[model samples]
Target: MKHLIALATALTLAAASVLFSAANAEANERYGKQKVVYHINYDGGQDDKKYRGARRNIQNHSNAVGAENMDIKVVLHGNGLGLLSQAKTNEALRGQVLELKGQNVAMHVCNNTLKGRKISYENDLFDVFAEDIVPSGVAELSHLQLQGYTYIKP
Candidate 1:
């Protein structure tokens, strides 16, 4: 009976150690590195919930990965352009964008929309750069996914 009790105790300790190690490894993996693409295609006017959710999604993602440990990109296109519209680019939006930028989040606008809507990037966008403009928004999301980026259309 004593030997059996000792064996059981040893087995329990080994199992506990393994479980602890596995949990630690998982935590490390979560913070190591991650890539994600947020797809925003609906106009804020028509889809207020989605727009708000997208911002919340960004915040939640940042919270999840410590913001500093993850790479995030928000791809805006079509009606989604409203989110970054010159008129809509208020202090809150700019602050959020700037904050995310500081956290290494890249915001890419759709060049196709700019061309189709005759929107001047210089006058219409907040802090978007030329290189940040992708050829097509949908295609960009697909490409990012293919490149192992997790897509979140919030």
Candidate 2:
């Protein structure tokens, strides 16, 4: 009886693994290779929950499409810069940003916003560099869309 139970458990585990793989394969086929840009323009400092939700949405989208098959860009402008600023102090938000960065999600900041707000990318924001700054966030979004990237605002 013990041997039979063990065999059954092993078989069940194997079947479950196969099912999971099949589901992932189906998702890969459905999504294929995608270029997606997520837009953010709200102040996370005022409403951290919304910004956190946006991060979650990005992660969920990546998971659904498979990170390897995704080209994800996060365009931040205006108050959206608060997302990274909050991350500097909020451990949870910082971890999420790092995880997304690890998954190859590019975070682009608006040069105009930086100048207008006088926020230093080198010190004020988390993990941002000069290369990450776009001349204008709205223009960048439009350019990305013209280049065949699907726009998503979450």
Candidate 3:
């Protein structure tokens, strides 16, 4: 009985693995290699639910396209900077940012917003670097679109 149960579990695991691989292959075939930019320009709300939803959307997009086959950028400016600011003290938001980063999704902060708001990227935002700063968020979006990146506002 024990052997039978163990065999059933192993077979189920193998079947799940095969199904997952097939799904990934199908997604790759349908989407191919993609360049995508997600724009975040609104305040995520008092509880940051909107930001959380945006993160979820990005994760879904990455999962569907396969991170290896996608170049993803997130452009934040205006009230969108709230995403990073909230993440500083919000563990869940921080984890989401780190997970997206792990998937090679670049988070680009607008230099104009930072300067206008007097916010320091090093001290105010979460895990931002000099390379992640763009002169203007709108310009970055336009540049990315010109470069063949599909724009998504979430």
Best by TM-score: 3
| 93-124: candidate 2 lDDT, tens digit per residue | 89999999999999999999999999999999
Go through the candidates in order and give the clash count of each. 0, 0, 0
In candidate 3, stretches whose alpha carbon ends up further than 4 angstroms from where it belongs are none
User: Which stretches of candidate 1 lie above 4 Å from their native place?
Assistant: 1-32, 46-50, 86-89
Worst 10 residues of 3 by lDDT: 41-50
Model 2 residue 101 CA deviation in Å: 0.6
lDDT leader:
3
- As a TM-score, model 1 comes out at 0.74
Comparing candidate 2 with candidate 3, which one achieves the higher lDDT? Answer: 3
What candidate 2 gets wrong by more than 4 Å, as runs, is 1-9, 45-47
- Using all chains and alpha carbons, the TM-scores for the candidates as numbered come to 0.74, 0.92, 0.98
* Candidate 1: RMSD to truth: 9.3
lDDT ranking, best first:
3, 2, 1
Winner on TM-score between 1 and 3 is 3
RMSD of each: 9.3, 1.8, 0.7
